[model samples]
Target: MNIKNRLTKLEQIIRPQQTPLVMIKFEDDWSPEQQQQIDAAEAQGRMILKVVFVGGKQDDNA
Candidate 1:
């Protein structure tokens, strides 16, 4: 299946009212083009993207 179809299926399983923590990992050396694509996907509002960078240490509050 295509990405849009897969995303739609995921959205059906996860309603808007419900908030879930989502993490997307990318290589530290990701190219600018790759970053732009990620930004564009976020702009589409198809899903929620939370960008958090942690180096070894974890956030206890979470």
Candidate 2:
């Protein structure tokens, strides 16, 4: 699915009190331009963006 569709699906599964974090895993190197885009999107408003990095396992007991 596309990014928008994936995001919508995530929203449907997530609850009001639950906060879902988006982790952008990059295998290769990342450029400053790409980082700027992510930053701009996150600076919009609360619940507008929830990005985080996950190394291995994730907890879903929140």
Which candidate has the top score in TM-score?
A: 1
Instruction: Please identify model 1 stretches exceeding 4 Å from their true place.
Output: 1-27, 48-62
How would you encode candidate 1's per-residue C-alpha lDDT over 7-48 as one tens digit per residue?
998988896543433545565654686567667666765455
TM-score of each: 0.30, 0.28
Enumerate clash totals for all models, in the order shown: 0, 0
**Model 2 compared with the native: what TM-score?**
0.28
Pairs with steric clashes in candidate 2: none
Specify the poorest-scoring 10-residue window by lDDT in model 2. 15-24
On lDDT, the leading prediction is: 1
CA lDDT, candidate 1, residue 43: 70
Q: Can you write out model 2's per-residue Cα lDDT over 1-62, one digit (the tens) per residue?
A: 89999988888688343343343546454457656655665675324343445477778885
Off by over 4 Å in 2: 1-27, 45-62
